[model samples]
Target: MEIKLCSLIALLGFLTIANAQTVFDITKCGATPNSDITAILTKTWTDACASPTGATIVIPAGTYKCGVVEFKGPCKGPITFQVDGTLQAPTSPDGDSWITFCSFENLAVTGTGTFDGMGSAIYGKQKSKAVVTSNGVQILDTKIGTGDDCISVGDGMEQLTVERVTCGPGHGISIGSLGQYAGEMPVKGIFVRNCTLVNTQNGVRIKSWPDQEANDVSDIHFEDIVLDNVDNPIIVDQMYCPSNLCKSKGASKVTISNVSFKNIRGTCKLPEAITMTCSSAHPCTNVEMCDIDIKCTTGPAKAVCTNVKPVITGIMNPPGC
Candidate 1:
């Protein structure tokens, strides 16, 4: 027993020291508060990604005006980016995304800060407030308001969990616009819960490009969501024609299955509270809904369902698909 206890203590001590090895504070590393710190932040991220012990890059409490920032990685160890401040994007009409992370593992960004897009200046130009591509990502307790999707999970992502997030004045949480290109990676094991979206375009949507080859999206869940006057609130638009000019030649080939929506209640601005416009060739399968109540401002809430049948339990506002 004594030897075991000593071994446990030694393990704990080693972990403590390992965690303390690389801690980078952006403010101390030549980042100016309330200014465009894109250059400074990029350097800090590079250093953190290169750390042998992995690192924790802290964005302390302050306002930072940033441009397009991308953090790509295969870091040696686990990495954490703690945002305790406001990160705002510039008003560039050609901006892509405010902050983008790609090809990471075991990354966590958690705090009480805000990711502001100032999107009105360049509406429809910015894609998302933040886009992440990784395995094992946790985004918690953050507020996002942007031009496009508040938080979008791209391809090459798995085991993603998002909780306690607030999104608005933008497109809501989304999984795709996948299957756009060839050789795309499959996205799986996604959970989005305890989210609030207000005055957004869509809530909890999974969209895919039209006329693309088959892609697999499975085992996804969205629960405990609150929508306030949102349009097209709870949608799985398989034949997503963003340009409204998709050729009537072919249907979307994305295979959407095993998706669930539960405990979602809110108000819809339009009558179509739930729309599941799946592809005719490859329809959505095994979709489920429960305890969903959405009220519309005008007339009664309605649902447009096609190419999919859902398993429903509890009460659905306008009847589920």
Candidate 2:
């Protein structure tokens, strides 16, 4: 894995920051074009993290091949990782994640760059979970695609907002297959709005494992979304045992409540456009569907619901369940 740092002016350009802010450019820290910058980049982050005032680490415009890197911080001040280049991950999986930023008080990953995971090589063999375990996070104006879920909201996520994003060639945005492990925290206040999905397996789904530990998922909402040729446009699957792994484990103990799907219009590939198979043990409550107009390509669209009674209002093409 090597990074090609082509320009020197781009490095100097980032150094010219505000008076109180310090800049750490990888090129200045012994990084060269088409060379392994793992060590140099780590050193740069260390220096920036030690700064008393705020600091920014800049990766200039070029193609860089990087291995597994974890940027851990308990810095003295705020930190920003600014990238204006493409970052290509290793061909083979090195760790759970290609890049990780953890334990930061105030951190920003702002970039016009791309993080290419090189997932095509090992698509079906090994799938990675792009998990989100944070609060007060906002993912806006971005495009994401992968073999697995484009964005998987994992356990302990709250006040998360994903808006104006385009997702496709993937499993769309999801809120768990939660309750797999014991003592998992609740997920609340998730909002996904104004997104577009094309050729995805599922769109805007919330899933959980059956016969698992008890957990609460509430205040989840999906609004103003558009789907094209998607398999399942809107779904809430409590019996989400992929590959029939858990045969008949009583029912999911996860309690889902106050979920709304509003103003979502699109075309679905399957006739069952909306499927809400909630747990019989703890059925979903306060589920609402409004202004939904999804059509099936082959036949008439329909919705299948079990253990969930949604409050339907306005223009339901599939005739809300």
Candidate 3:
């Protein structure tokens, strides 16, 4: 495969600060067995990504334990948390968010490390709310876990992108419709590319409430993604009636348009191959699907479109070419 990928950028202009930025090096800070990391990470000794731009947070190779990591501002602009080790959070059953970056932009997490949200004790009737928070979160060659969404974008989220991310054994990536409240504003300008999934619920999905609805979702594109043992591969199921109380309510107005899928291959072990349940009134249109390959053991490859435009140029399997 080509090493071509786009960078996820968030907006926040910065001017003052040392070297026009700052660096938080956890290694040189001696935050180990002898050092008090919690204190160093506080305003007394240190602070979490505050007033940072053109700055980098370096977590050199080590296993560090933390709680409720919240990034406070200027999280935009070439910020790299070169995670060279594991940053783990406590396990909670009550369902809590591991790391949250709100009202921030231009963030990237890179390294051969992990962020373990020891949340094995948690359970949810659904795996869709955790990622409803921010924008421009890039999981490049990094491992994140436990919490509801490895990464979730909620309200006022635009230009959000997830690339080269490996998520599984946790809640998959969910692009929400923002319901009727904060939960119902609609995520736009989303681009998910070159990612892998293990045992996720729905790989590459666009979810909406059974009741709430958004006006329109423009400039959304998902491409070059892979799923090993995911359930719903290519799901655009806007007809979802959350809790099954009203899947037929037809209040789903989240129009997903200008979507292009290319080089997407996966194995759907549960639901149908491509479950495209859109509104007949305002069916999703201008969708260019090229090179969609799937390997389903039993079921068939069935695609339903109302007023949508799907250009199938490549295939493999019974759904094969």
Candidate of highest lDDT: 2
**Alpha-carbon lDDT, every model:** 0.80, 0.81, 0.59
Error in Å for residue 4 of model 1: 44
> Which has the greatest TM-score?
1
Write the number of the candidate with greater TM-score, choosing between 1 and 3.
1
List the lowest-lDDT window of 10 residues for candidate 2.
Answer: 1-10
Candidate 3, superposed: residue stretches over 4 Å from native: 1-21, 27-30, 33-39, 42-53, 75-77, 92-95, 124-135, 144-149, 180-186, 245-248, 316-321
Cα displacement (angstroms), candidate 1, residue 28, comes to: 2.3
- List the RMSD of every prediction in angstroms: 7.5, 4.0, 8.3
TM-score of each: 0.87, 0.85, 0.78
lDDT of 3 by residue, 1-321 (tens): 111110011112112456676555654444553232443343311233544346666666777776655555454355655677777655552334545555556666687877655555444422444444456756576454444555555656777777888877655666664454533555677888888877776777665554455556667788888878777777676666655655357546567688777788878676465666666556777777788887665566555454465666666332411
Clashes of each: 0, 1, 15
For residue 133, model 2's alpha carbon misses the true position, in angstroms, by 2.8
lDDT of 1 by residue, 147-241 (tens): 67877877768889899998887789998888777888888889999999999999999988888756788889999999998987888887777
Better of 1 and 3 by lDDT: 1
Model 2 residue 265 CA deviation (Å) reads: 1.2
Residue 271 C-alpha lDDT in model 2: 94
